[model samples]
Target: MLEELYRQVQCPVLAQLEIGVTPCALVFLDAEASGSPNLRCGDAFSYVAQAVTLNRSLLNAGLPQLTIATNAIDLVDDYLSRLDAEIRPAVFPLRPSLDLAKETRFYGAHFKLDLLEQMALTLPANRLLLLLDTDVIAQHGLDPDLLRRCHASGVGAFDISDQEFSAYGSTRVIDDLELVAGRPLRNPRWFGGECLIVSAEFVGQLVPVARACFGRYRAVIPDLNHQGDEAFISAALNILSERGQAIIDIGAYRMVGRHWSGSTHRDLRWFRGCALLHLPGCKALLGRQANRRTFSSARLWRRLVLKHELNRLVWSLRLHVQSRRRDKAIADSPEAPSQTW
Candidate 1:
């Protein structure tokens, strides 16, 4: 299934890149060593396989460089041998001396450490770093020209949401920027953390500082309160702001299977612009509903068109079921009052 997804998307991406130009390299920071129970091993393997296929496709398409970075040296060795040396994977080890002390489980800190390890292996000032999560899969190849345009325009981020920014206190920095730009920087949106494109220059500027900050603060700070790399990024932005550095805000990109929590329908607007779709929980849902003939794409379209009515029906059914359960519970209760409210 992973290989199939790669074949579908990677072929087109490679065909589009210029022959002489240096191609972008996709990077992932494997966090398998952290032993976090929340970490899904299957998802990690699927992601790595997809990356391997992408690397192979890009090389076949004539891209100059394709690399993978991971702290799992043995895993990297096994993967390269399995691929028959088709994909060149890079091994990055965690600093042996760095103390990773924690009172309880710290997922965010683990992620920050992983990011730092990946960043350390990046070559200086030329290549584009395509950072992605283990659960995310590319649906379509990115537009090379569009990516270049974004870099040229100094766009730091794409698909950022205001809510996420507020959650991270990034809005405070944006408000400060508004004061400098002499305009309001309102209604900023948050971007998902699944994928990001970072230029070598930006990485050079931010990665070191983020590492230093994390290293300095990791031991003393409470695990629950620490915001990890994202918060560190927010801090880096703050530092840059103080130095009069400009931040370019690129608007949202199309992302499918993300808003599935709200509704199952795909947003056409997202499809038109998004290069990737994050199917975090869709695997189970799609599998379960696969046998239902009524849940086909055509029927899904019908559901979208009549969303309100369907939602109402679902809500009514839930309410009725809840009422019956409540009544039954009350009837069985020994201390139940006779008066019905």
Candidate 2:
């Protein structure tokens, strides 16, 4: 079943690149189509800007980078064309799986699993693969020894089991996954989808099980109750751990801070110490940081609290209206013509 997903990947540069020789970072971006109601930004270009900024940070950290993108390939190419060859990653084109897109709640969340399955098939065994969401920004180079230790442990993920948000309540994830599995799980955990550190060997084991678990979940769970990739993968990890797989909680090591500036859970002090930060609520700030070529944690907070709140409120209202208008248009539209011509 996973083999079908490989059709979306076009890795023209994979042959030229060396994979297992050193650590590599895989950043995934799926640009929402033009004129769509994008929650992250006003348009797709802002998302591309964030991705470019992220790729640069990974390159600066002395790691080879690979970017998997859909729809924004032209924009990414244009952006990388202006930069020096040293900073540009081998950007692979991944057409979004339309079926999975409709099946999942989030637009592109499950694409990571597809890419992970692809990586498992392609990359050398036990090679370190740091999968990062486009929203993540690196403040400093990651520690090599620390990364190796995490890699040695089979998998490393930021534990979000205790963190609860309205959209995705982490507390209920285990129970929900258990319901999907049709049995109770042992030592199950919930992870934020922002950053995941995995070995290619581990991925080979993980993706199959994750996909299977997700298949069961999608079949049994209601569309409204469906959680995205993180929960499904966590369920698979928990199952594997019970069978003697090592799943390390990288949150304890402060590898990455999942920071949303607009939320009450925002912790700048803790975020400062982490090498990577996932700023989901600050896409506009990410665009600004990308364009300015400077990143300041202090500036992020100031802008979010002082300026962006009102703008965000306005944007939200505008988006809501646009969505309603689109829905009404679809609902009122005439049926398609017959093919009997």
Candidate 3:
């Protein structure tokens, strides 16, 4: 199954810009596969704007940047060009496999995992790769020694062990995944997909396991609510760790998820000290920040925490009303399923 998946998903990189003088590099993924669901927060320009904001933040932090884009090469290239050539991210244009387009559940999130697998195979093994989401921003520069230490240890990712962020994982999800993998997880903790730091060698080892798990997950899709890459990748890491592989929880020191939406409102006091902030549910703020010549984090916070919540309330209410109307319409339809059980 793994070999077949590799053959189907693997494709040649059309072109790549070279990164200079950095053993560690950062790559942000913002791509939509051909014939795949368009699940970006906003239209094409919005998310690309977010990535532009993130790229500038990374360059400010002294990290060389790269972008792995599929199907939207011209758009990403234009945005990255806004940066000066010396620090602009090297854009690698990849063609997404048809298998990636078939996924309806995740809307091409898993496709990036396949893209990362290819990156692991193509890029130099000695250099470390930081796979960042477009929604995240770097708060501070990382020390050269710290980057070396993380790369030496193993894969770096955010650990969401606290029960507060139940959206990331649960006992039920782990139990189901363990049944699929046919192994019990020793450290059953959830890792967010927002920011992942990995070496090419480790990714080479991890992708096969994740691919196998995903292949098996197809049989139980109806039984599972969460089928994204985060769950499967977390399971794969746990399985590898049980086999003596090192998996570092960089959430403690490197990055933190700022949950300023939904029921999870994390304290912002700790965010100031973190090196990176994964600002999910705040794409509008990100786009606004990108247009500015200078950004103020304080204003970003006020708009995100206060104004965003009000906007979310209105958004949720509208969704609820739309859902209720849809339910009524379904009930009225002749083809609606009989409610009798």
Candidate 4:
């Protein structure tokens, strides 16, 4: 079923890109689950194909030569058969020593490890490597100047929602970042795991740390699951920053969207000229009803007004009901005191 969908979805995208075999790679880890009513293997395959299609289009438009790296076991070749001949897939085998018994809440850690390992092995010694998540679908073609800016930035990272940590029970992850970065880690207004760019030198530095951290934690915390790759990354930056390393140098252009709280801040006026806009969570935001979409504003006045009105209405209703209940309870009392008392 997905084969048909892949052909329908991917072929057109390839045609749209008009790309001859390029040097860029689009990497994805396998979907973890076996099967479900809402999402089957076929569905996963189709979704990945759609993502690749969008990525390929972006690459062809001007990003860079693309290559895809993923775990060998997870990526099915048959699904990729229809892609353009220029597109190549590099598969990395799962590490033999990785203990499967060590449970992790951080599913993204697996993908991050796979990406870092592949980058360490296959990435050119001094070229740029863009690491985009499988779920990210590029809506616009990247300009070459933007690619240059990312390369020049030394390291590029995106933000995720602060709310996700509590939702995922990952306060410990925040502590880890603070320890590594040294200073208190400021929670970005917007947080998510959508995209990252790594220079060859940065990859060399980060791969070892990521492996060590994953290995150590997997052994001790058998049940720590979380989804913030950026958190782990932020921790790494903290470590480098303490050592006086130029941890993350934002490039000439900011490569994320204005909708993100981190990007929306008035303090982020510096990023006004950024080239890439990480549009994580925009799809769901776009899907919401108009009333719900009003919450996307970063303005304090707007939010306070909306919140105040809502709270007033709810509290007024609650107080009225509570007063009536109290009066009735007194009337029902057998030896009621005087009303004034």
**Candidate 2 structure quality by residue, lDDT tens digits, 178-210:** 765556876657678788888777887887788
Q: How many backbone clashes can be found in candidate 3?
A: 0
Q: Which ranges of candidate 1 are over 4 A from the true structure?
A: 1-47, 53-66, 84-98, 102-126, 144-146, 153-155, 163-192, 215-227, 250-272, 282-341
Highest TM-score model number: 3
Q: Taking the candidates one at a time, how many backbone clashes does each contain?
A: 11, 0, 0, 35
> When superposed on Cα atoms, how far off is each prediction in RMSD?
11.8, 13.9, 11.6, 14.8
lDDT of 4 by residue, 1-341 (tens): 98857754765533233212123333334456332122223344543453444344344445554445544444546555645545423334444223433123434234554565555566554455666544333333544444454455455555444444543435665654544344564442223445566676777777666556555444434343432345455556555545554433332234543333322232333423334343232322222211231222234224323444455566567667978988999899988876773
lDDT for each residue of candidate 3 in 134-219, tens digit (9 for 90 to 100)? 67777677644445545676577788756424543467767765755657876676677777777777887888888777676666
Give lDDT: candidate 3, residue 230. 70
lDDT of 3: 0.63
lDDT of 4 at 81: 62
Q: Which stretches of candidate 3 lie over 4 Å from their true place?
A: 1-41, 78-88, 98-103, 122-126, 143-145, 163-169, 262-265, 295-302, 305-341
Ranking by TM-score: 3, 2, 4, 1
Give the lDDT of residue 268 in candidate 1.
Answer: 40
| lDDT value, residue 268 of candidate 2 | 47
Q: Which stretch of 10 consecutive residues in model 3 shows the poorest summed lDDT?
A: 12-21
